[model samples]
Target: MKKYKLILFSTLSLLITPVYANDNAEQLFNERCAACHSINDNSHITLRERLQEKAPTLYYAGNKFNRAWLQTWLAAPSKIRPGGYSFFNNVNVTDEGDVIDESKITTHIAVNSTLAALLTDYLMAQTPKSDLIALEKVTLGKINRSLGSKDFNKFKGCGSCHQDEEGYGGVSGPQLYESIQRLQPEFIASYTRNPEAWDPKTLMPNRHLNDNSIKKLLNYLNVISQ
Candidate 1:
């Protein structure tokens, strides 16, 4: 009888531990992250609110980021966008051109390894736009580096905002060289197709790229990321 009671207790503990951990993670996120990063669905966000947002919305983080990359990034956060999340707040008009005021750019809050893992696990479950991600069909194909570079820099003009290489291109947007590692492939394709659908007030313009163009861009991104 005692042995059976012990076995039941062990089984009950195993079932309850996951729920407890998940609850703890949720509480931690609410305390440590809710002030800056929003975990709620922000589809109805106004332009004024978006302009005032301190960080990117994480409601679709599961669909947007690679799990490994998100986990690693949380442990030791680095500057992805050189001009910060709201670029207008950090730009300084200079004689040469509009330069990013590095002083205004603040570092992301880093978490310890244990907390990072817990937060990442919780954040990675917030996939509200799984349907949107599903609609994107990403296929890796070869693209000529010279032609791709020409299209990205001159014709498409992505270089005006994003960097394809370190210390090169514009600084207003996140660096694209590491995007393949940082973002999910489906997210990359979907965002490229329609940035406004994902981020209502994003500075990225709607290029209305066709399927072939988007695929070519994805190929280019993969190449550069490698």
Candidate 2:
């Protein structure tokens, strides 16, 4: 399986032409990723649903992804859904009631390091206009008693249908004790804006929060960074 994976990655690298060979990551991003993501848009939609029927934007890539992780994810594209990505927007379903189409789900084979590095660098360069909030700079002391409770019950409403820091919320979406460390912020933001953007058939709802909620959530995730 390891050899098979290597062969697959090699085949993909070969497919990336010499014209694109040694192509600057930014240039490659412009040519390949710009169509689906915005560099600075901060609109925050719902968990499963996207503002538009597209995937999320990338305004905060710099703040979100681990360069190493980014490289690994992009070298190969995987099916993130059981029946592919879709939303329950039209269904008026609750997050608790929502269901993922597992039949359409699949994972991508890992990629070679060089291609991954190029993609990671390209993605990491994207930054939002906001000043460095350094939300990640917050100390472990801050996440103690009161603040931790606030994270569970306050404006975040994370407890409503998902688990995180306190593990007190509903079990709807993925856990987030280290979500910031796990997901690309840009990817998360973009998905927040438009769940259906990349996969038109996802089961998540489209959140329609104003800009403030978006920033707050972003900050919340940064604070929760592992």
Candidate 3:
């Protein structure tokens, strides 16, 4: 009889453990991440609003980021945006135009291992309902480097905000030349399909390119990353 009672107690404890952990994660995210990021959509916003914002929205972060990457980034935060979130306040345009003064880039907040894991768990659960990314089903396409370069620079005007080469492109966005190293190919495809899906208040405009174009862009990213 005592053995049965012990078994029941152990089972109950096991069941309760994950619930408690999930609760802790939610509470921690609310306290830490919510302060800087909005878990809601704010993507279709103006430049003034973007300039005033403190952090990027996490409304679709689960769809946007891989769990492993998020965990690693949380523990050892690195620079993503060249000019920082509030670019108007942090970056200054020179005689040469918007050059990134490294000193003005805002540092990311770092978390300890435990907090990082908890935060990552909570963030990974924030999946947006979208069919844009069929991760396992989608295959990468080949890039014509020359044409891709033209699209990235002139046709799409992505160069106005993002960087492609060492000394080129704009300073308002994270450097794209290293995107293949930093992000999953599927993530790149999904983000290109709809930037608003992951970041509602993103300054990036959705160009509505076909899947082939997105795949080519991703291929170009891979080539550049190497």
Candidate 4:
């Protein structure tokens, strides 16, 4: 009778303990996705790095992707690329554009549906620690695309490696058409300031701009986001 009671208690502990102590979802995320996605800061490598392809960072996954959509995406990985998620601009890690290999991504372990649901629930709960401050109230008007092009090419030297319509840059960086929606300013600013903060293997060079240029570029990015 004591052995039967011990067995029952052990079974109950196995069932109930996981609910309290399990963090497998995060472990799974770190193991599978951390190679490509960043959560906190800029990477040490250039944006052209293979590990730095065009996938949106998980740092803002809580903000950008809706819960239901993320879950469905996990269950059945589909082609979300129109042209490609990551494109080469000019710093030149590869030819054309770099593509993030998301073809064999696993949203959940091959466990039962119940465990899959639990993983999804945990993943959706991860929100960025920083608040995203929208610049809509500050800009008050649209940024001129022509001026933006000029600034990107001539003033900031952004076009030296990144591609823009001005026909003056390299194809080493990712295209920046709708990047404002994809990247968080916090990560962008930090990377702009220091690429080593994120990944140690980045190839992008650090800029020597003063504070004013940084502010201008940041504001430019904010303006384009609109």
Give the alpha carbon lDDT tens digit for every residue of 135-207 in model 4. Answer: 1122223456777667777877876655553233554454444445445455455556665444355556777
List the lowest-lDDT window of 10 residues for candidate 1: 14-23
Query: Candidate 4 — which residues are off by over 4 angstroms?
Result: 1-23, 27-143, 164-169
lDDT (10s digit) by residue, model 2, range 1-226: 9999999999888755535456576666665666766665545545434535344456666656666656656776543222222233222345665444444344544546676677677667765623433222332222354555474557556555555554344444555555566665655565555555533544456776555555556566666664
Whole-structure CA lDDT of model 3: 0.75
Query: What is candidate 3's lDDT per residue for 1-226, written digit by digit as tens?
Result: 9999999999977754443364687666765668788877676777677667788777767766767878989999986777777776777778979766677666787987877888888887776644555652446455778888898889878889888886678877777887765666777877778887766656688999986677677777877777
Off by over 4 Å in 3: 1-22, 43-50, 101-103, 134-137, 141-151, 196-201
**Which candidate leads in TM-score?**
1
Provide the lowest-lDDT 10-residue window in model 3.
Answer: 129-138
Q: Where does candidate 2 stray beyond 4 Å?
A: 1-16, 19-23, 30-35, 40-50, 75-86, 89-96, 104-111, 130-137, 141-156, 165-174, 183-226
Q: What is the C-alpha RMSD of each candidate to the true structure, in Å?
A: 9.4, 9.1, 9.9, 9.6
- Candidate 3 lands at a TM-score of 0.75
